[model samples]
Structures are given as C-alpha cells and as structure tokens.
Target chain A: MELGPHILLALLESAVSTAVLALTAIGLALVFGIMRVVNVAHGEFFMLGAVLAWWITDQLTAFSPAVGFAVALVLSPLLVGAIAYASDRIVINRVDYDPERTIVATVGLLYIFQQISLMTFGPDARPVEPPFNTRLAIPWLEITEQGWAVYWPWGLSITSYKLAVIAISIVLLIGVWLVLSKTRYGLIMRATQQDKDIAQAFGIRIERVYGLVFAAGGALAAMGAVLIVPIQQAHYLMGGDPLLLSFIVVILGGLGSLSGTLVAAAIIGLSNGMIAVFFSPTLAKILATLLVALVLIWRPAGLFTRSSR
Target chain B: MLELSGIAAAYGRVKVLHDVSLSVCEGEVVCVLGRNGAGKTSTMKAIMGLLPLSAGQITVDGTRLDTLPVDHVAKHRVAYTPQGRRLFPELTVRENLEIGLMARGEDSRVLDWVLELFPRLEERMNQLAHTLSGGEQQMAAIGRALCINPRFLLLDEPTEGLQPSIVALIQEVVSTLSKSGVGVLLVEQRIDAVLSIADKVAFIENGYSREVVPAATLKTDRSLLEKYVGV
Candidate 1:
C-alpha cells in the first residue's frame, strides 16, 4: 500500500477534477432530470461565472484583493442563477419546456451568453487571484536512489485553493443532497419529475418550480467556475470542455437522476484527472469522449440506474 | 358545488365534448356513466382545465373555473384523481401525499387524517407507490386527493379493475367523503357499483352529457340502466 509522490500528486489532481466535473455535470443532469431539457448552454453558465469573477475582482481589487475575490465568489453564482431564472421564465417555460425545443433554446442561450461574455470580457483569457495563498507542498513517500523516503520534491507543490475547492465542493454537494432529499423544495421538484401533469393537479405551480430549478442548475455551474477560475483562466470559449465533459457524466450517470449523476461524475472526473496527469489534457478529453460513446451505446441510462428510462 | 352548463371543449380541430352540462351539490355523489369514448373523461379534463374549453363555462359554488389554469383549478379546492391512479410512482406514499399538502401550503397534519381514512396506507406510508398493488395504488391516489381537503373530489374510474372487496372499500370511502360534505363527481363505467352510492347520475354520449336522473330511480328500473348505459 506504499504510494509514490508522483502517483499521489496525480491522484490529488484527479480528485480536484472529479469535484469540479461533478458540480458542472449535476446541473446538466438536474435540468434534464426535472424539466427534460438538454441545456447546451450549461458551460456558458460556467464561463460566465469565471468571467464575472474576473470582472468583479478587477472592480473590487481597489478595496483589497481578498475582499474583491470574496465578493466575486459570493456574487457570481447568484447573478448567474438569477439570469438563468429569467431565461427560464422568458424562453424555456414559454415553450412549456419541450425536450426538443429546449435543446434548441439552450443552444441559442449558449450563443447569446457567449457573445455577451465576448462583448464584455473580450476575446482574451482573464485571470483572477485566489482569495488566499494557494501554494503548498504535498508530502509523500518517494522511491529514489537511496530508498523510499518521505519528502516534498520540487514540482510536488499542491495549491491550498485547490484543496479549498475540494472541501467546498464536498460540503456543497452534501447540501444539494439534503435539499433534494429533506426539503419541501426538493419534494416538489421530485413530484414534478415524476409527472408534470399530475404535479400540477396537486396544485403545484410547475412553471415557477421549473424556473427556480433552472436557476439552481445555472447556479451550480457557476459555483464550479468560481472555485476553479484561479487555476484555469476565464475565457469566452472555456465552456466547451466543461459542457462536453458534463454531458459525458450526465449520459453515463443516467439523464435526470441526481444520485446517478454524482456516481458518474466521480468516475469520469477521477479518470479524466488521472489521465490528464499521466498523459495530456487533450488525451484525457479524448478518452472521456470515447467513454461517453461507449456508455451511450451500451448503457445509455447511466451506470447507477438499473435500466434505460 | 360544481356546475357545468353547455360546456364544450376540443383537443385540436377535433372536438371531444360538443355539449355537456352537469351539477353536484354539496355532500352529493353524482356519478357519470357511459360507454367507452363517450367524453366521460373529457368532461373531467375540461372541468380541471386540462384542455381549453371551445365554448361554455365551468363554475364551482358560483365561482368561474373554466378560464383558470390546470394548477389554478386545484387552487380553488378542486382535486382530480385521473385514471390509472397516476400517483407519483417514484415517490413514497408520504411524499405523494405531501405533494398534495404542499400544493395548498398546508401542514403534515393532513397525513394523520388521510391514514385514518385509508388505514392500509398507514402501514405502507414509507413505501414507494409503484410497489403497491392495484387496489393499494387506488387507495393512495384517493388519499393524495383527500390531502388537499378539496371542496370537490373528482374521481375518474375510481373502482376500475378492482376486486370486489376493494370496490366495496372504495364505495365506503366515497360514501363517507360525500357524507362529510366533499362534493363527489365520479366518472365510472361499473353501473351497479357506482349506483350504490351515487345520489344522482348523468350519462355522457356522443360528446354530450344527458340522461340526468336520480340514482334511486335508475336502480329500481333495470331497463333504464340498459336504455341509457346500453351495456
């Protein structure tokens, strides 16, 4: 059970990737699961979070870098969620959340959000400093000429912010689980998921619930973006990778099942992280896409679900 | 009280209900009997605002309802248990009824009242509704509707495909609900079972509702049931 420093570092990176991927994919799954909408614009919400984080930090840097980053972290997801709520009310709900039409609408939403981010954030990739000092050395046993020894090597430094991201994500994911399982809000959403018509018959305002769930989904995407902007710069086109990876997770997990999305996200996220660390990020993405194809062909419902829905 | 006078509704260009009129006073059990595809279900759909009325109006205790949305129709204290139970299959019995309670922003206190009515539901309160048998599913559906404590209880084929014992159970429940002053508008095909509790009866035919009469009279006259229901 002895682990090398290189392998340990790679494992850590994969865990981080898994956490971010879970956050991104869960929203896609939620939208599909509850409202039966394929939100192609999910990544745009992520990109918008990073873009807003940078802008907010830039504006608030005058106060203090710490204050600026803190404010942006809190505000970005809320703003993204609010915008998503408005979009649901305006476009998605208008069409009654038709599965086919929402795909088109969200694709339109993707472009609209991208173009807006482009006009505002510019074509250049923007960077934001972490709220706290991120650099830290990870200790691990290394096999060298001497023997297996515990040491922190030159390139084995772990970022404190990355660990924070992992911690925050774990808490947030747990919070989401509690919300869906324990709260009335979750109860209502689950009801809507089973049968929108029947839910309406019980006096549920399904339109309002749809709008809020859409907002919550967007907010979740923004959450990951806000946490990861320091590691990955804010770029208008950054949404492509996250969106694709999320689709992979949601498809592998089973569309519309949150618990299933969590399991699939862990698998995809960890593997992609591990692959990227050993090989290349591009290779990681290729492998993930290949896995998506395999899952879709074999078990389209997802890994956790017993059968296709 | 639910009253529909000259109400007409359609799906697309095709009209399902050309003309329908029916009424159920407080504490009254009015069963609508008809053959298949006779607009029996369509009449309930129209009253629940599931379909846009092509013409005419729907009123509950003198308040306008035809123009209300499907969810809003429930807001007026009208509960409809559609055909096939339609309980949220994934939800636990408690959760399904909670959806009913949540609809009206009420408390979990209604659960106790519901459990008392369908005591079988009390034991399976935590079980997923889909796991229940046909009779149990029907009980859960009725329990969910009653959680709303709605003024009108609309049942579409409440006793369809049930064992005689279960049918008798539904009969008792419907009778109790009506006696408790919850107006019951039942859509059923089983004439003999429905007439056991129905105070009045209406027959929907060829997209129109007619043959309105007292159930007691219809029960005595077997020829009347044959002539109207034509079974």
Candidate 2:
C-alpha cells in the first residue's frame, strides 16, 4: 500500500477509534466525577454491555439488524446502569466513604463479573452482527450500512458501524454536557461532586442523585460497547483493553473533567493509529503509556482538573 | 416553629447530646451557646436528622421530624447551614445556589432574594466556590442555604473564621431573617454577636442544655457565660 493513502486511512481509523474511546472514558469520568470512586470494575460493566448486545441479537434473530442495533444501543446501557445502581446501593453504600474499602469492593466485583462472563459466554469470542452492516460507498472508500469501510484510498478501510459509533459518541458527549450545564439536575450533580456533605445539608437527596449518576455512567459504557462490538468482536475479556484505555484517558485528560477526557482520547487514538502504521501496535501502546506516565509525573491531577471537590 | 425535647445523641456509645430541649417560634432568633465540645453542633445535627437521636423527639410546625430523613426534613420547610461554610468547593457559585433551590423545589424565588442580600455573589456567580475568599465563600454558603426558603433555619457556627466585617454581615442577615418572620436557631462562639441578635439564648454545656432565657437577661449576666459557655 502507498504511504499517503495508508496514512489517510490510518488517520481516519484513528479518528473513529478516538471517538469510541472518548465515549467509553466519558462514562468512567462521569462516575468518578460524582462519586470519586475509581470503579475498578468499570471494565466489567463494559464487558457486560457487549455480552448483553450479543444475547439480544441472538434472541431477536428475526428482527432486522437495524432493529437489533437500536434495541441493543438503548437496552444494553440501561441494563448495565440498573446493575451498577443496585450494586452501588447494596455494596458500595455500606462502605461509608472508605476509599480503601471501595477499591477492594470494586476489585472484587471486577473478578466476580469476569468469572460470570467466562462461565456464561464460554470464554470464546463471538461476533455481533447488526443489520446496519449493509453497504454504501464514498469515492475511494466502501462503507457498509453498519459504517465500516471495506476499501478506501489505502486498501481495505474501516468499518461503517465504527464510524457511526464515533458520530454517536460526539452526539452523546454533547448531550451530556448540555444536561450538566443547562439543567437543574446538572447543578445538583456539580454541587454533590464538590461536597457531598454540604449538598446533603442543603437538603438534596444525594443518594438518589448518586444512583442516577452511577446508572448514567454504566449506560454510557454500555453504549460505547454497543458501538464497538461489531468492529472489535464481542468477548468475555473485551472490557479490559477499553478499561485500560479509559484509565489512560483519565490520566491524560485530568480525572473528572469531561472536556479533557475527550481531548485525551483523541490524542491516544491518533497516536495509536498513526504510530502503529509506522511501527508496531505494541510499540504504539507502550509509547501511549509512557506519554501518560510522563504527563502524570508532571501534573499528577491530570491535565485539566479544575478543582471539582 | 421548631422544637427539640429530651434529645439524646451518641456516636458509638459516646453521647454528645444529653437531654437537650429547645424551641424557636416564628420570627424568633434563638442562639445556642457553648464551647468547642459543648454539644452545640450536635443539637443542630439532631434537628437536621443528621444524627440519630437515641431518645426523645423533634418537631417542626407540629410535625414530627425524628422519623424523616435529612432531605425529607428539608422538604418540610426546614433548612440548615452546617458549620464551616461547607460550600461545594468544586461547583461555581451559581451552581451551588441552584442546588439549594433544586432541593427545596417551588421556592426558587429565594435565590433572587439571597442574591439581593449578598450582592457579591452576583458578580462572582460564575467563579468556582473554592476560588472565592473565605468571607465570600461563607456568604455563598449562607446564600445557598437560604435559597431553600425554609420556614425554620438552622445555622451552625455561621460566623466562624471570618473577618469582622463578614461577621457583621452574617449577623445582619440573621437579624433580617428573624424580622421577616423566618425562625432561626443559631449556634455561635462569639457571645456578643449572638447576644446582639438573639431574641433568646440557651446555654449548652457538658452534654446538657440549661434553661433558655431572654437574650436581654443573659447579656446582663456575663458570669453565667463564664461559668457555662466559658467565654
């Protein structure tokens, strides 16, 4: 493949990847933003999303792929959010703001969920086929109904579904920003994040707000999974990589800042894609981690923390 | 509008409030005076339902408050400003005030009144709470609480760690609230500030509440504060 065309393809792929990663990291950031709990098992929540999507597709085999995609996009996140809410209330709430206990509890949830995924899904990779993967093309690129490009300026291009996923990520990010900025709910969320005790003193039902926040975060992670499953293929262990990437996003963007998370995701995505084209994927990942570590050593609080609490 | 009777509270067997009793009628400013560990805050916490009372009862406007949760209590027209001007340090000043209005619901008009009272908040509405000076942040905290539009207000050490001007500003707000028919229960370390504004004064010490009397009588009896509140 010629380098120019290949480079364009890589950048396109990187842009889509960054969008997906940003969507995933935004969920993590939302949870951390309000609760200040790292939710170490957040990756497990991501895995659950993929598994749920796959299960829904299998159960609704008679439905159109678009219907399956739509259903999965909405339901997967809701399911994960419900589970996150229940788990937070039942388990995390009991710890009473003990950070060490929260870390341990979430880690336990991670392994427990991982084991469940293994048992239920049989430890094998499965492809999530949604009807959206039909076909469309742009001059040099071939796009499927699902949004994956089979052929592009370079060669075989990215998936249409992944590109759609990127589009959705941008929309969802904007939607969340509006909710946090313009709505009364957003005000309460910001207030609680700043000082939970003070929020309670002001008479806000902080517990309900927390449940909503956790659910929202879970839903976001699941939505990201729904978008990515077609491109990445669904598996029990699919969440770990995204989880790692999200952690990197948090560190690179500065923890709990949504704008920073999106920007960092873009940086990671572009660097990973372009560097992989020139060198090896593994080398690119190492460079990403190294860059993240260097940024942390310099800033510690991430790149754009604005004193939330 | 607010009443506490024989309230007893403890944290893991260490009782902080013992058989405390107090009441505040509408348009009244009642001050609870005590030293650092004199259970003054515990009284406010008990009223706000933050501390579970081991015994006795609490009521506001004749409705029992002991059974309600903290948020529900606020819904019943009770508002509280905790000690230390506990503003949400992360949020902008406007967002902090907005949360108070959100919690109270239907009384959002109070936000405008509070902004009128603390005009500094108007200029710095977009700034983060943490960025504000101690006095400005304290004003924001009080404004946030007042935005709830409570019939009964519970203020715990509202004037702590601030300049004299800010202290005067707070006292004026409390006095204005009282005159406007809002019942206020305050805890203050500064005896003169409390005496100046309080309609009635109750001395809390050694985990018990002594007889509450007119602020005028307590002002003349400085020896009483020396014996109980210890300055």
Candidate 3:
C-alpha cells in the first residue's frame, strides 16, 4: 500500500487540529497557572463566541464571507472578554480563594451560561454558512473551497476551510506568545501569577491583574470558537468537548506552564485525531483519558513545568 | 522621618503591639530588640501598613501612613524588607527588583542606586530569587525595598537566619543608609549586633516597649540587657 498520501493527509489534519487545540488550551493553562483557579465556566466563553459568530453571520445578510469571518473574529473575543470581566468582578472575585468553593462557583457559572445560550439562541445547532464557495486545485491533490488541500492519493477530498482553521490558530498562538514574553504588561502578569502577596508588595495592583488575566483567557476561548464555527456548527452546548480536552492539555502540559500547554495541546490533538482515524472516536477518547491518567500517575506536574518561584 | 505613636494593633482578636511609640530621625539607625513574641515584627508590620492599627498614629514625615494601605505607604516614601525576605520566588533577581520599583513610577534613579549597593545582584540579576542563597536573597530583598527610594526603610529581622558575615554586611548597609539620610527602623533579635550600628535602641517586652536609650549606654551596660531581655 502507498503510504505517501495517507501519511500526508494525516499530517495535514493533525497540524490543523493541533493549532486549534493549542489556542483553546492556552487560556485554560494561563488562568490556572496564575490564579490557581480552575475556571470551569471557561468553556461557556467559547460557546458564547460560536453562538455570536453564527448570529453575526446571519445578521450581516449581505456581507461577503471574508467580511463575516472578519467581524466574527474581531467581535466574539472582545464580547466574551467583557462578559468574563464582569463575572470575575461580580461573582468569582467575591468567592475568595477557597479552592472547593471556586470550583463549584465556576462550574455553576458554566451551566448558567449554557442555559443562557439555550434561552437566547435556542437548542438547535445553527450552521454558519460561509458567503461564497470557491475551490482551489493543487494538481491531483484537490483543495476545498476554503483553501485546504484535503485530498488523498485515492482521489478522496476534504474542505480547505479546515486548513484555514489551522492557519488562523497558528497566528493566534504566536500572538499570545509574543504578548506574554515581550510586553511590560505581560511581565507584571507573570509576576503576579507567581506570588500575589509578593506582587502586591512589589506595587502591582492584584485585582486589576486578575481581571486582565481572566479577560485574556476568555478572549482566547472566544477566538477558538470563531475558528471552529465554520467547520463545527454553533450549538448551545458546543463548549463541552473543548472544555474537557483543554483540561487534558493543561494537565499533560503541567499546571501554569505556557509552553507546556502548547506541547500538550499538540500531543492531544495529533494522538486523538490519529487514534480516531484508525479506530473509533470513542476509542480515541478513551485513549486520551488513559494517557491523562498515566501522566497523572507518573508525573503529576505534567510533561513540562514552570519554575514556580 | 518615620514616627509611630500610641499605636495599637492585633491579629484577629489577639492584640500584638500595644500603645507602641517609636521614632527614627533622619540619618539615624533605630533598632527594636526583643525576644520572640515581643511584637518586634508587629511594629514593623504596622509601620509598613501591613497590619491595621486598631488605635494609634503612623506618620512618615507627618503623612499619616497608618490610614493608607500598603501600596500607598510605599508612595509616601516608606519601604519594607519583610522578615523571611518574601522575594518573588518565580521571578529573577532583576525582575524582583523591577517589580518592587513599579510604584516609584518614572524614576529609574532608585533602581540604579539599589544595583550599585549590591553589585553581586548585577552578576546574578537573571537568576530566580529562590535559587539565590540566604545572603544573596537578603541583599535582593533589601535592594528591592531600596528601589522605591524610600525616606524610611523598615527592615524586619534582616539577619535572622543569615551567616555572621552576611549580618555584618547588612549592618554596613544600614549604616550606609543612615549616612545617606534614610531613616531606618531595624528590628533584630541579636541585641549586640544591632547595638553596634544603632543610634538608639528600644527593648520590647511582651507587647510593650521599654524606655528608649542611647545605644552607647546600652552597649556598655550588660545589666540593662538582663533587666529587660534575658536568655
């Protein structure tokens, strides 16, 4: 059997999924790393973005696909960030730092937000239809209307939009990395994350830093939602899968380590995708679960660790 | 420039420092010597605005520091090198100093002065604070506080767990700060080490301080140590 085409297709799909997975997981890793609060409501922010993207696409009526995509990308994250900021100040901040209480509070927020999505947008999975459909030809490897070369050597084809999803994910991830490493604000955030009492002693306003961190997580989740909506239809409960997967990525990468989150995201995405292709989707999920269990049993700090100084 | 009068404080319902009155003149080293639970740490905390004063006044140049919060107290030209050094363990030595100077806002001169005081800090500036030895961390903690260019520095047990050489080095730093006209309230357990450098010394027994005396008088008289502080 010719392995060339099969391998190429697998690699491409894995690459795309890996990028998307990284974006989704980075937010979870950051919030957990800094505040040490597990934000169960984080997934709702992604669902909010998907629902908003679908709504925006429907409302735009006459806009081009490019315009709709652009609007969704810009608007969703900011909207979700605002919601997160409000929630942080109003509810999460008031809970203090009791670990058990925070978990319950955020999980409650997740369900409440999920219900809000249902109430506002209804229960059906709404498809966000792109404005135009155009296909690009890559010789024998035919690409989709969305610029993804999704063809095997057996004349099988897939959508190019999925490739676009991968590309956008890479861009966002790099942006987050640059912001965290290069900016002055990012430095303060990292310092605050390490030790809140010391950070305040150093003259950093901790409450403000927390708000910014929550917003960063919310924005990333929202961006992930927009990236996936064209491929995965928008639904009230769409955030469930991403939320579960993000936890796995965060644990596999190590708590509060940024680079670890990215690596774990890739491992999770590629392995899950490959396993699902060879076996059943349920089997792939079980494998991911087993992998997490093994990681927890062996190295509870995850694959990579930040020096928690 | 730092003064605390009739200051009363507590942790929850348990009172720690009671009716404490102390002052450090500009360019003078004032040391508070006490055995454990004598409220030496509580006095420093009150001056740094970490503990809420149940009753009393804390003024840095008559600015009423006690009413203000911790961050605002730094703005009033007061800095604290807390006991245990409390350095940001995750950050590098330089980053620790940098964050400590954030409220100084628009002034890089203080940063330069701190670096100058501890040149070893410059060598290991990129290393994490936790990775540093006790001596280096003590220097970093002091350096971090000094980066605020405070008029008054509160050092709580700076030599608590340090080696003799490091303790001597810190004594020298306190002396230098005095020469530079920064008032210092040095809290210490080793009365002899502090007496050597302090202009005035006060003994805290239980939660109240004894009468303040000249360090010269306290140094010559071992009887006073026996009366107020004992092994």
Best by TM-score: 1
**Candidate DockQ scores, in order:** 0.79, 0.60, 0.53
Model 1 chain A lDDT-worst window of ten:
A1-10
- Which has the higher lDDT value, candidate number 1 or candidate number 2? 1
From the highest DockQ down, the ranking of the candidates is: 1, 2, 3
Query: Model 2: residues >4 Å from true position, as ranges?
Result: A1-5, A60-64, A94-97, A130-153, A156-159, A287-298, A306-309, B10-15, B123-127, B161-166
Model 3: CA > 4 A from native: A1-4, A130-152, A155-159, A306-309, B6-19, B53-57, B163-165, B227-229
Q: Name the weakest run of 10 consecutive residues (lDDT summed) in model 2 chain B.
A: B102-111
Candidate 2: residue B40 lDDT (0-100): 90
Encode model 2's per-residue lDDT on B21-78: one tens digit a residue.
9999989999998778889988988888889999999998789999887778878778
lDDT of 3 at A225: 88
Across A1-309, the per-residue lDDT of candidate 2 in tens digits comes to 666567777887788778878878988898887888888888888899999888888777898878887888888889999998998898888886467898899899888888988998788887888556544333354458988564545253656666677788889889989998888888788877877766776777888888889888878888888887877778888888888889999888888888899888988888988898788989988998998889878888887775334
Q: Tell me which of candidates 1 and 3 scores higher on TM-score.
A: 1
Q: TM-score for each prediction? A: 0.94, 0.87, 0.90
Q: Candidate 1: which stretches are off by over 4 Å?
A: A1-3, A141-154
Q: Rank the candidates by lDDT, best first.
A: 1, 2, 3
Better of 1 and 2 by TM-score: 1
Give i-RMS (Å) per prediction. 0.9, 1.6, 1.8
